[model samples]
Target chain A: MSTTSPSRWKTVRSETGRALTALVIALAVALVVILLTSADPGAAFQTLLTAPLSSNRTMGLWIDDVAKLTLTGLAFSLVFQARQFSMGVQGQVYMGGLFAALIAMSPIGATPLAIPVAMLAAMCAGAVYGFIPGYAKARFGASEIVSSLMLNYIAILVVNYLIRAHLAPAGTGQLMTAKFPDTAIFPAILPGTRFDLGIVIALVSALAVWFLLYRTSWGLKLRLVGHNPKFAEYAGIRSSFIMVSAMTVAGAFGGLLGSVFVQGRAFGNLAQNFDGNLAFEGILIAIVARSRPLAVPIVALAYGYLRQGAQLMGIRTDVPTEMISVVQAIIILLVASSFSLPGKKLFARLRGQKSANAATPEAAK
Target chain B: MIELLLTVFSATFFVTVVRTTTPLLFAALGGLISDLSGALNVALEGMMLIAALTAVIVSVYAPWYVAVLSGVAAGAMLGALMAFFHLRLKADIILVGFAVNILATGGTVFALSRATGGDKGTSINLPSKAVPGVDLSFLEAIPAVGPTLKSLLSGHSILSWLGVFMVFAVWYFLFRTPYGLWLRGVGEYPAAPEAAGIPVAKVRAWSLVASGALAGIGGAQLAMFNYIGFTRDMTAGRGFIALGAVLLGARHPVGAMLAALLFGIFEALAIVMPNLFNWIPGEMIQTIPFVVTVLALILFSYRAQRARQMRTLSKI
Candidate 1:
């Protein structure tokens, strides 16, 4: 085990290689599909890969999208680390948006104080939402997956109802809330684009999450609990408490993203089409990042770029934009399966006994 | 009021329940077989969705049965993909299931558009074939109860009868065969069978394929018989509901059938309740099936825990 410590870079390289392998497979599949359907697959692929870098505006939009995806991905990584599969990030985000809307509409405070308060309110709402499943799982042994999933639908419906009944703008035909006040919006950092201070917040939150999960005592205990509840119990850690805390933190992060989106881009207005695939996209990002907090931003950026490219692909080609979704699915399948590649044998020889220890994490559940 | 009461007791309601239950029953059986073999088949929703679309598209050019078979084959192919990732490539089964679901959600819409020249929804414009209904009108000539029996049990899609047959077929496959024992042993503890030289990965792979094929049949029934065409998201969470039914049914073929029937009755009511109660919102009525699923699952978990507690107390 001690001898393996010096080869950390090798581990990183191999993991990076595996992720790239998955990306290559996705690209290969997309190429085949494009060639079959379009008159120019090579041009389409080139457009997808390079369109974001072609213009400053496109680059800014790409950054904004990556910021949102990264925030949600971080949220997922936090909860998943505790071995709780909470699919409630979307629900939490909805609540956060609602809180932001309420605050924006209210005349409670000055602009500077109001924005922070609204963001905090959103975070609190998200934390409470997450706490429900965590408590249910710890106390009653309810499946978090089912509860979290059910809550997502409930949240979406409730938000839709609210937007239609009370939050609708005076003359709007569709179910959407009124535009928020200028003061409620986040200050734009990049001119001529939606890019705002939210990117900074997301990056700061990622760092905070990294610190919490790796540098803090509570984080250690949580990881122990996740690795083995029985072993953690023997070590005097309260596994249930850790589970609840982790979920709460995860939900808070999700809420923060929602608040950021509402305050920055949508101007605290809710729309009926707000069932954005952000939560599911975040799940995919978490998988591609292998649930690593630090890796989330990189994966999110890649996804954001792919999404933009796919949209462009749709415009330039006869292929539907859903082809991007197919690519995403393929990426997930390949990345999740990359561990079983034959090349793993080479690493196995170098690590030897330590490789067996790694197997424990796979069986933790 | 009296007429409504009579209608409630009439054969139409019974037939409606059976019709609604057919797809759900098939999906539940699919879910059950995979779950007992430890795979859980979370992609049932996606498989059903894709297969539904496939059945509708293929039925346009082929016989209804051939269309259904093609749907099943498509589902089996997806199952094989999942097996390749899960058993061969060592991917997480749940994640693989989710990937399939995400793919199905987006892929079907893409395919639907391509097939319908950018229609993006309900294959209503497509000239799709319908599964034939079994006419038991001959039963009316037999006896005093024949007319009632014919009305209550006849005129269902031939697929519904096949669904009933599948329930027994799945039961026999899981309990009465040597392969069944091997599959069960693999699910419960793979090491035991691995020691016995039975290929655990192969069993899991086959189970996944069988699961997908069963789900495909359910999808075919939904498209070809239930509404005579495919619609985007027509499976709507039926696959997930079937998953709950798997657990609520105590993981048995009979239990799964009953559970599916219970959900089917509620679904049929959701379809009928708007006519009966003009005051309630349609959206609220549409929520009945999801609400029922969550409640049923909660009740199932509570009962299971109670049973465990009772056993512990008895032992003490």
Candidate 2:
């Protein structure tokens, strides 16, 4: 506990080095895969890492991907921080997208008001969706993981049924919903690019989450509850309330992601494979970021780059884009393993101190 | 109405149920073994997917049995890898399971295209061999019950027969053997076994590998017999369903078998119903199995809760 400052720095450096080593190992495996399958491994690697940043348009796509991943990652981070494994973010997103599309298509309000209303509806829908599992777990002591996982399939199937039965536009047979009106569309920040105001919302949301989880008394209570519910209860904290609220907040974040994707990117339409596996990707990003709200955006950007790079690799070389999935799997394996290592306790202590110091700055002011 | 009922109970429906249940039964057994040992092998889905592809690809060159064995070996290797990471490297078991799943989802497709010369969806063009069905025509010579027995048991894959035997073998191993007790003790409370000088990690690791091998066999059944070829996402959530079955079966070997059979019945219906009821869409029909899984789980949970409540009431 009374180690020298240089020694502490060395410890931090070593942890970072271990993390980088894991990433390097993953990349090496990918490189071997590329070498085996493709004509040139070096060129494939170069294309994968650099091509996403090569042009404005490609950069914008990368940003768009990051925005979506950030939103989902933030959702997962919030829930995970409470020690709640809510795997139904995928389901919540489906409901969110559905509600957003419904709002966008309905002639209920003006365009300016309609967008926010749609977003709010989506958030509320997601919150309600999450509340069921949270309530079940809190009251009945049911396993949230099993419930959440089951609900995901139900949500997908329910959405699929709705899209095919009522929401589908004329001449559409692939179970896709009708496109929203032009007025419901999100305004793009970059011309001729997918980048939209969603990026700003995602960044602002991360900042808000960081503040909420650090500066507030409730945040401290939540953390205490997450770490040890019995101790938190003894400390006079309402653990159930925190659990429900945390889950609702997590769900709202998931809803926001889906709504933003629908309004900004997909133009308020839902496809059969509308999920795009973003929820899973978000889980990976959250794990990689160690469930830190602030770190989500950074990790999400890296994920976005990797995804874009994988696509580029697929295009330029014989390497299939699915290699990205393999890389993600390897990274999770490495990261989860790293976290369980003996040195991670020291790393957590350091992180705890850093977060505590960071929390005090706004409090002092 | 009688004709419709007859059609529902026909040989085709029977075969469909058998085909659907074979893989699910194997996977359920896999899940039960690991779970009983206190290691929930969530990677069953991923293992099955990879094995299905492996079997399909390998069958192009080797015999169907060899292909199936290759798939099982692949799953065993993955299980060993999981054990290495989780037991030795100290990784989270769930995370390791998910990593395997993610790898399977992506790796299978990548390898599939390479194997099939860039086809991503189906391995129809590949000369993959089918699992040889058991010739039970000899049963017909056994008198009156012979034809009935042949209809019930005949034309099933060789792997299906192995599945039946493995169930009994697994049950025997768990109930009678010293290793089974050690595995169960490790799962229920690792500290007790650790105190007794039994290597807790080693038991869990072997359980995971065994689970993976069982799941791999299930995958081979799916590719070689169920559909006769591999398709992208052909398991379609059966692995997860098998996980549910593991619980619904009360985490016992026999219970898993019954649960698998029940789900197989629903899946068989789903497959057969679309053809019979022209009014119902194929997608809706296909969703029956998943829907039934949720309903069955809910009922199971409700009953468990009720049983607990009753016990408390009796105590009071």
Candidate 3:
């Protein structure tokens, strides 16, 4: 036990080192952007470091962002865990939001009575949107990445057309539906913040996903299918069905995120491209967490804080909030990298592998 | 509808189609190169956006050709960076490509604001130069056919002619050259080439660089010739359409050009249709190319599958 403990500790240490390296590199790049763009780099960096935690109000804002990002991240984790790279999470979200609005606005329903119905309709729409690509991949040998990406553009445009044609109130001067009813809007739970019960739903769903992935026999079979599809088929597992269901489940989570977005009180209307970055953010969060459901919410919160801080930095300093995108990209590159300096032997292999990466970064020129 | 179709087939419409097709063709060729070398460049959209901004910004201080070269250099550097992460650091190629895309999306906005002194929406405020259109007025001096040819082909950007020449060039390089054979071998079965002492990774690296350079030129054409200014996300879905074109073209250079022209015709139609059909929303009309991409891909895949099954049956 003692001997094994040391080896385990070493692995833990290396993992920690790699994570820290990614953080350091990402932050350093962000800082360089700040220095280059801002007149007062010190103040800019300070706000970036502390603005998310500066006040209860800021904290609430950060957590509200985290709630939505967590749900989207959960949506991506479902498909990613099955070894299927579905790029349709945003597409599903777009469908969900549009369907949710349509159902909520239907004449047959009372105001409060329609919210749950809207959520269900949204989930169904998302499922259908996901199923198209799922079926294509399962039956036609088409690439999920390409099909889903095309679907995303279609979904966005279709939703945009729907909003303008049927949903938008006359003379609004913008392509958005009218305000949702009071019953549709989620109220703030925290006194001084936009934090709402939507977060509660997201937190519960993350825990539920964790349980479903770790403690269920279905999870085991699904993982087996992902680990080796041919072996799973030999073992009588319906791998294609699992693949489709994984996408369906993922779509459901995306739907939930959209439902939450539309139900906010102050900003209850869905706007153009409001679903921006959430899909990619979901992918990034899953990558950071190694696609573990339990770790997703944590990564979402961390990313949420950075985004909030970046926004604050934009307001307080000369920096742009878009800098966070560059930071996030670099973080993803570093974290997903196999290079590490923890072990001397491992370090040598990393150095020897590339003229681009290790020998000369200037080789990119 | 027949009258409308006839009206749409004028020299003006054909010229618009050629103009739209040039950028798509360049990007499609770029996609084809990387794809043939076993690296699908999903980052074409981002590369084009960055290069568009780069070319537009550089055109303020340099010659049009120099600005275009700068854009190509920027894209090549981005491609090299992607290879660093994908090949050396061992990240998934798609994910790395996506990261570059995300970086481009934000980085371009930040850079635009800096360059334009606060405008984030476009580079409209800059005094950018455009690629000169060729004047074939001499065709008017020749004869009867000269007037027709001048109307159809004259006034096109010089880049458009290069784009046409590039189609044949890419075809010859891919089908008639040793390096092209090596690239195909590397993509199909890298092990065979590796055993034969070819540097598979190096080939892939150079293919990505070439891919990026070509896409960069496409961006330059979009900003410097087609549109004459840079807008955020102006490449729009053209990069993606180019990818679909690569597949729809059956992954061949000549096919890529034809596929690009097909989409470009729809895009040209979109540009003109909104004025004619006042009732249909412009956004809805703009989706024609993307919708066509999906339908064409589905049809292509279904047909390919049936063909494969038939081939197997014949063997039996």
The candidate scoring highest on DockQ is 3
* Native-to-model Cα distance after best TM-score fit, residue B277 in candidate 3, in Å: 0.8
How good is the docking of model 1, as DockQ?
Answer: 0.52
Lowest-lDDT window of 10 residues in candidate 3 chain B? B1-10
User: Residues B234-314, candidate 2, lDDT per residue (tens digit)?
Assistant: 888888888878878887888999999999999888877766788776667777877777667766766777889999999
What C-alpha lDDT, on a 0 to 100 scale, does residue A201 get in candidate 1? 82
Task: Compose the digit string of candidate 3's lDDT tens values, residues A1-365.
Answer: 12498765665455546666787889998888888888899999999989999888888888888988898888887887787878888889888888777766666234666777877887888888888888887777666777778888888888888777767887776778877766766767976578887789889989988877777877777777777789999999999888888888788888777777776543577777767666678877877766667778888888888888998987888887778888888877876767655565666666785333332111001
> RMSD for each model, in Å, please?
3.3, 5.0, 4.4
Q: Is candidate 2 or candidate 3 better by DockQ?
A: 3
After superposing candidate 1 on the true structure, give the runs of residues whose Cα lies further than 4 Å from its correct spot.
Answer: A1-6, A108-112, A266-268, A339-365, B1-10, B142-144
Ranking of predictions according to TM-score: 3, 1, 2
Report lDDT (Cα) of residue B99, candidate 1: 92
Q: What is the lDDT of residue A158 in candidate 3?
A: 83
Instruction: Give a tens-digit lDDT track for model 2, residues A252-340.
Output: 88888878878885355766658678777887877777777877898898778889888877887777888888788888888777334
Q: Write the per-residue lDDT of candidate 1 for residues B1-316, one digit (tens) a residue.
A: 6755666687898888898899899989988888888897889989999999999999999999999999999889999999998987788888899899999988898889888988887788999999999999999997899999899888999999999999999899889999989989998999999999999999999999999999999999999998889888899778888887887898899999999999998888888888888767666677788778767777777788889999999999
True contacts kept of 2: 0.50
Q: Write the per-residue lDDT of candidate 1 for residues A122-193, one digit (tens) a residue.
A: 999999888877886776666677677667666776777777767786666668877677777777787777
Q: Which is the leading candidate under TM-score?
A: 3
